[model samples]
Target chain A: MKNNILIAALLFAAFPLLSNTLVVCPDCPVNTIAKGIALANPCDTVLVQSGTYYENNIEINKDLTLIGEGMPVVDGKEQGEIFTVENKYFYIEGFRIQNVGRSYVEDRAGIRIRKSTQFTIRNNEFDEAFFAIYLQNSSKGLIEGNHISAHSLEEANSGNAIHAWYCSYLEIANNVVKGNRDGIYLEFVDNSLIHNNLSQDNIRYGLHFMFSDDDSYYDNEFVDNGAGVAVMYSKNIVMQRNVFRDNWGAASYGLLLKDIFDSEIFHNRFNQNTVGIFMETSNRLKIQQNEFSENGWAVKMSGGNQTNILSKNNFLHNTFNLSVHSAGTDNVFSSNYWSDYAGYDLDKDGVGDVPHRPMKLFSYVVSSTPEAMVLLRSLFIDLLNFSEKVSPIFTPENVIDETPLMTPLPVFGKV
Target chain B: MFKIFKYSFFDLIRSRWTYIYAGFYFLFTLGMLMLSSDLSKVVISSMNVVLILCPLIATMFGVMYYYNSREFTELLLSQPIKRTSIFTGQFLGLATSLSVSLLVGAGIPFLMFGVFGSDQAGNFLVLLFNGVVLSFIFAAISFFIALKNEDKIKGFGLAILVWLLLAVVYDGLLLLGLSWFRDYPLEKASLIASVLNPIDLSRVMLLLKLDISALMSLTGAVYRKFLGSGVGMAISVAVLLIWTIIPTLGIRRVCLRRDF
Candidate 1:
């Protein structure tokens, strides 16, 4: 039976890349995948046609492109990691791979490319594979246009869709990642371009990056994920023109910038997330021209990080413009259009005459105790906010926009 | 004791219907494993499915195995043998065969997943293994129901109902209680549920082993905080053994007192 072959093939990964197209029909040639790889040559492409191909622990150690023809179904049958690719200049596209065994220690995946350079994985679909397109200790890779969905249902059950670990010069774009713990994740990936991806409906963040430095991302859409994008402990990153929307939860954010330094966050659209941007211990960041709309909390500053500029932005329809746990020092909030700002323009200038203190006391309470969300729409919340604004007690005193702009914005650019 | 164990084991194996039930059970398990997506939930949910199957298989086989082997048992009783040994052999045999079939049917597929270090893997193994344990437990319980309850059909009904109550209903009522008292530090409520039912303990043990202790929320926290991993593992194994022993001992007591 096909199940027997699948069970047997799980220990190996070679599904054969011969002549760029491989067909794995029932009683077809080569039920055991690694065996077929011995006959395969470099620069050759393997086409896995529409059937269940059982690949038993085949290591691709040559230059080849593996493409699945006619939506071939590759079942690892819950045995182990299905495909292990170690080839440079390898391109794998268009296969439905499922039931790859989950392992935390192994960092397993449907298609795991380790120490591989300049590989392109596109148009492939993964179902419940722990890490769909996992690049570990690999450099100069392109993981694009892959559709990956894993059902975790429990935290221990799922892994990231696209996980890049210790990989540099990676281009992860145009991928649709969903259902896994995190979609399109990069850990210790350096100098990469992550853009134009649709990552959503995941258990955790749509896109998460940590210890990844000098990476620039723009024009990607993150929607309906548990949390939005999280950039942590990385330096000199550029995040521009991305649409962060519909991530609504108690602990969710449009973008979470934590322990990061010297990152440029510009022209990003943060909508309907719990908090637009949560910055904790991030310093020297240039925050410019971003649009924050319909979010629960626009911005929350927990640590007293310094020298981060917030200017030329639009904050509209968020319940609270900002929440600060500490008197976060040396962060500028100037010339930003706040929709909640009722201050007048006395000199007929575009700028407001009166300075606006954005943070409210209720936000402070909510920051301290999450249970205070039940008191959100009450008069007590309003009274506390008004009292704090009148005298500045609960929130950060120095965190205020000196020149709150009167007009909405010149033109909110596409992000 | 050894003689009785031998006699029971053969009796259950000889019952042709037991083999048929086991075959069908294996097929059903395979069908579910292939068809279901969101495999983790499918695993936990299948516990109830196993519950329904285990008791039915156990009770029917247990009742028929004991009833049909009455003549053979009487023949052994006429020989140089103690009544307790005859009873023990029957109990041991039925429980052993049921456990073996359950393991063969479901346990190997789960292990074949090779998903070590995942909560899903641990959860699934426990779930399927619990089926094996429950088979033995329920088989022993059925012996008492068949002998002491007078009517064979009534004993079968009660056995089925008791299995349902233990496997499913108790947890439902406990959840309702936890949900009702939300803000009352109900984190410890999970431990309460575990202590109340051993299946819940098995489920929790599997989840905890997966290294995903964070998302378990209110009750899981209590378990992690109070009962350490060692304690949890010990408790799970103990519960399974307890489930097996209680009915076997109960059946022996019933058998000793009953006059044929």
Candidate 2:
């Protein structure tokens, strides 16, 4: 009975000793923020106030909430790697960051996650760092509501804004990425949902997904990038209701598809780019209910594409309707409204009488010799295209839209 | 004299720290390529750091050596020799020390051609140019400082300011130009603007060798595409030469004029 009373007294004494909050102030006892964090437990919250703290290479390796109050900023001190989070089930939110070192040897970031799970990073800002948020060799992460900007002196010197490599099960939503090498980049990522992001004006593509398969991206706007988006070497992808607009360059496009297969591109807008949709060696894509307008070329399909479906789409006011490198047959160009379609709808069902042969001979010649684009809109090229269309000598005979839609579908404008 | 070169060489021979640094860099380059799934990105990235750090190190070393060699320089000047010969010897000695050591250090990783290793090795030629030009640029600057000032910190400050202004701050100025002159094809003007600094030129030429000229397309795309062929490449080489020779000759003239 005496020993039990002593143990109860000890427990009572320790009640007021444990504190769950960390406060960062200039007049505080400790000067090193990292040292203070080291003394904290997993459930503690680190509340840093507004001051430009100069610290370098911080590793966040616990399940704690790092909350910045009143715009507290953590500088890399112009040294390197501001915060590296390799912890599971953590939340890092509400800070401003700047001046991460540029090391070509390592994949450094304002926040780098490795082999972690169920993490959330939101409501932060980063500037002049190599990469804003770097996700590598990790899974099941949520990156949302971060505004990131970067300044790269040279392209070779710059890194991506948000980069995912060899990672899966990501939920990236509602972020604004601007002025980095690429706004958002993914390579070999899978099972991800990218939605509601505004990525624009980056040095390269706004969103670059290469070999990232089984992912779905919807309701994102990619505008005024060096290139819009480069989708290459992937399968089982679904791109729906996204807006690819205003990304213009000499060789830029709304989407550059190379070696892609078995994807569904639905209800997207391709607007005001050099080429609306450029495809090469892509096959078996179901392009449905999409709108292509005011682009240089509505669809520039090279010779290597096969077994694709162009159904229930609208092509309005593009300079050239559909430019093909080869007259690939049985590609199924049906139920799409072409604004330039001039055939009569005599049956009163709003369908054209003549089948539309989209592959003009001049488009093929233009593909072979790009300099012949200068000869476009000329009388000789028109006569040549018409003569070839009448007998179908140069273009494939069966590559035609059997029944063209007379009226465009109501789906339009940045869907 | 050969004695001066020999003495200068032996003077800073205790920089075994350079050996350790070289080993670290070699390991870094190789380790980066191995860890990276995209090997070309590693090389491209390594090239970027190589240019920036290499030039800074060369420049810093030259400035530090000139300052530290006060007594040594005084001893050589006490002899009945011309000041130009001493400066030339120092310049050659500095260039040889930094260039040869960097080549051996940076070249060892690419001895085995990993993925994109051949292109990387091809780009080693450019790296070599960067190292050579950087060393020469510093050597010329070192000579001017070695002639002009007796203080080391002042010379270092001048050199640092110059490199910073040329590489880092110049882009900000270009950005300012873009904002100021919104109507003109200022990007096209930027191509000519890059000619003002050789560091930018080296980066441009190396990127051109990579064959994705979209970056140049905005600024000097017309100039690079039109003359970037044979004659254009040759002219770029000439421009690189101008960056080196003009500065070196100015140092040579200063060495002739100064009564060290």
Candidate 3:
């Protein structure tokens, strides 16, 4: 036992010799981040101190830990990509990077990880980077607590904040992203988790998903984005405890689902958006325990969505509760609390006696002739809506909440 | 000028039409609020009414007041008051009373609904501001028309015609122009046309503030940049101010030269 202990102690003491801590400073022999990485061995840590390093096209080819002390400024000088990692077990934290050149030919980024596994990127700030953190074929990664911002005046020249392609088993949490083309974009990124993030004021959708499957996002706040969040051509996704607010634009929505299949969206708040949730050609979705308030149109389902269940949700003070373009939609809406429902609960149950019809005739008219929307609040339109409620004609008859709650359901998620 | 303004304001306030107008607004706003049970919807409904009715009422009232008070003004001209002061005083008095009626009438219901404690207070304030500006602009234009035309029938007819041209015809012409120039970049042209008409300008301003979701859907970077930033708001407000000032100055100019 003593011999074994001595051997273990020797191995533990010798491990430090194998992995070195290389310091990079202006006055030191290793001044630049690239130089430090070039001299570093596998399992070595490269420490970068506080200074402005005007360099780009840095390549990290080994499994190394890069820690920045005092928040070093890595100015790409509008040159190119700052960091390109190709090896596994890479960890980077605490750096301020800026000014990566905009290129239409190449997808330049502040940090790009290629086919790397077991990587972590945290506590970094990126400004003016075309693509802040670009992950391609990366698995088992954690991208946490990063702040990315860009002033993208046009979409053709700008890139996304966090662009993930063909990535799996990734966790992106507690990051703030603003003013990019898309805040966080995922393409074919499956089995990932995104949570606790604030994405706002982007030039395009705050969070965009395309052909990504089995992903879950929770506790994320998206506000004032150009087109809000979009989930497209995906399946088996979960969205919960998120806040979509103030995404007010002519073609904007709090959440847009296109060609999506078999998703669950619950406990989300949609507030003051142009359209809270817009679904087109989506199927088999479950939407429950959500709060929709003060939006222009709460949910606009078109393109013949099928088999979606909407229940236990609160529709509070929305201009139009539901706008279903197609007359033969097979979606189910029951046990939901609609603030505009005028039916009474004479039986003393919590449900209204008469089933509440949410789709209005005027909304249908507005869909057909958009210019008629200017007469939205006019007495003529109000009279028309009232008469339609008395006898349904234009609005779809199937889109009714049979078990409508008399009072608003308790709001889901955090206020 | 102050004494003239004070008496004219008091005299108009005591008139039956002011109370009737205020009562109409009061009952309508309160009834809408009670029926809709939503502050924002009520505001929107009231905005539609204000946009169409304020200009019509202002035009008719301005013509009628100027014609009815012609003998009074002649008597005042014989008094020691300056001609400009007398005319300016009456204009200010008419505009101020109309604005007050609008404010008190709409303000009572909005405040009763606890709007001050709500998030839509800013939108409500903008609505009221648009109403006041519309009243001032249309009233000034009508006063100018009345000042230039000595015949009462001609003055009244021309005033209503001006209102019709602005409130309805201008939009029709604008839509026609937009469709005609559909192949060109007509965003700037449409925006300029809206700005030239005070009624359309105020409508767009209030719509931009209240119903932005609908407007933001418009296709064009210029519209987005203008409406999404404070620059658009400033420009709209500035143009509305110019609209108000220029017409009032026109009234002053004609009164100075006219032998009435």
Query: DockQ winner among the candidates?
Result: 3
Model 3, residue A226: distance off in Å is 1.6
Error of 1 at A384 (Å): 3.6
Worst 10 residues of 2 chain A by lDDT: A371-380
- TM-score of predicted model 1? 0.58
Better of 2 and 3 by DockQ: 3
Complex DockQ, candidate 1:
0.01
Better of 1 and 3 by TM-score: 3
Instruction: Give per-residue lDDT, candidate 3, residue A121.
Output: 98
Clashes of each: 19, 1, 2
Which candidate number has the best TM-score?
Answer: 3
Candidate 2 residue A296 Cα shift, in angstroms, is: 1.6
Q: Once model 1 is optimally superposed onto the true structure by TM-score, how far is the C-alpha of residue B26 displaced, in angstroms?
A: 66
Task: Put down candidate 2 lDDT per residue, A141-183, tens digits, no spaces.
Answer: 8999998887654667788999999989999999998888888
User: What TM-score does the first chain of candidate 2 have?
Assistant: 0.91
Question: Which lDDT tens digits does candidate 3 get at residues A1-415?
Answer: 9999999999999999999999999889999889999999899999999988999999998999999999999999998999999987899999999999899999999999999989999999999999999999999999999999999988999999999999999999999999999999999999999999999999899999999999999999999998679999999999999999999877789999999999999999999999999999999999999999989899989776999999999999888999888877789999999998999999988999999999888788666545444434544456678999999988988989999999887767553
Candidate 3: segments with Cα more than 4 A from true spot: A1-5, B1-12, B15-45, B48-100, B107-205, B211-216, B219-260
DockQ numbers for every candidate? 0.01, 0.01, 0.18
How much does each candidate deviate at the interface, measured as C-alpha RMSD after superposition?
13.0, 16.6, 5.2
Per-residue lDDT over A309-337 for candidate 1, one digit per residue giving the tens place of the 0 to 100 score:
99988998677788877774888889999
